[model samples]
Target: MPTIIFVQQDGSEQRVHADVGQSVMQVAVNNQVPGILGDCGGSCSCATCHGYVEKDWAAHMPAAESYENDMLTCAMDVTDASRLTCQIIVTPELDGLVVRLPALQT
Candidate 1:
């Protein structure tokens, strides 16, 4: 399992153990992490699972697919590091990945 860290807008952090092959949003939802609301159930249709990947760990993640990028356009507070957590699948190489929740989700 890979351990992912989710930092809330208030600076609170929740560390979760994600099973390999599960989506980051799934891990957050499963663990009851407060900031992520995966309204679309990992689908790219909703941007509710939006989050920002930590800069250092960003290099290790795969680029967002076209559909995911399209969905992100609907998210609030978008940034270069912004990503939809449902599109990020957990892998062994991604252990200790860190992501930060935006102040609000659209």
Candidate 2:
């Protein structure tokens, strides 16, 4: 399992262990981590699971596909590092991944 650190808007951190193959949103929701609503339940339809991948770890993630990139257009405070957690699948290479939550979710 890989450990993911979710940083909230207030700078609070929730560290949770995520099994390989699970979406980051799934792990956050399973662990009750604040700031990740997962409103679409891992589907790419909603932008509610938005977060910013830490700079160093961003490159470790696969580039967002067309649908996910389109969905992110509806998210608030979008950034170069913004990504929908549901679009991020956990892998051994993503161990210690850190994602920062936006001030508010769309």
Candidate 3:
């Protein structure tokens, strides 16, 4: 299991252990972490799972896919670190990942 740290826009942090091979959004939804709706159920169609990868860890993750990049365009208050949580798969190498949720997600 890898621990993923979720930082809310207000600066609160919730750390959860995510099972390998699951999406970061899955771990958040399953644990009921606030601010991540994941409305499309991990599909790239919705930007509800929008979040920002922490600056320090941003380079460690894989690059965002084209579809995910397009979807992120609709995210609220998007930033350079903006990413769809559903597109972030948890793996052993991704331990200690930090993602910041947006203020509001549809």
Candidate 4:
């Protein structure tokens, strides 16, 4: 399992363990972390799971697909590092992955 660090709106952090192949959103939701609303489950159709990849962690993620890019338009505070957590598959290399949640999801 990999450990994912989720930084919430008020700067609180939740270090949760996750299995490889699980989506980041799934880890957050399963652990009862706030901010990630995975409204469309793990599908890429919703932007409710929006989160930001810290600058140093950005290189660990692949470029967002066109469909994901389209959904992010519905998110708040979308940045160059913005990613929909549901699309972020966990892996060993992401053991210490950091995902910062916005104040709210759209």
Error of 3 at 83 (Å): 0.3
The local lDDT score (0 to 100) that residue 97 gets in candidate 4 is 94
Residue 35 accuracy (lDDT) in model 4: 93
Candidate 2 per-residue C-alpha lDDT over 26-60 given as tens digits, one digit per residue, 9 for 90 to 100: 99999998888989899889899999999999889
Model 3 segments beyond 4 Å from truth? Answer: none
* Total residue pair clashes for candidate 1: 0
RMSD of 4: 0.7
- Of the two candidates 1 and 4, the one with more favorable lDDT, higher being better, is 4
Scanning candidate 2 in windows of ten residues, the lowest lDDT window is 34-43
RMSD of each: 0.7, 0.8, 0.9, 0.7
- In model 3, how large is the Cα lDDT of residue 64? 96
TM-scores for every candidate against the unseen true structure:
0.96, 0.96, 0.95, 0.97
What TM-score would candidate 1 get against the native?
Answer: 0.96
Tens digit per residue, CA lDDT, model 3, 40-88: 8999889999988988887778999899999988888999989999998
TM-score result, candidate 3? 0.95
Clashing pairs in 1: none
Q: Judging by lDDT, tell me the better candidate of 1 and 2.
A: 2
lDDT for each residue of candidate 1 in 6-89, tens digit (9 for 90 to 100): 999889889889899999999999999887899889877889999999999888989988888999999998999999999999
**Stretches of candidate 4 exceeding 4 Å from the true structure:** none
- Cα deviation at 102, candidate 1, in Å, is 0.4
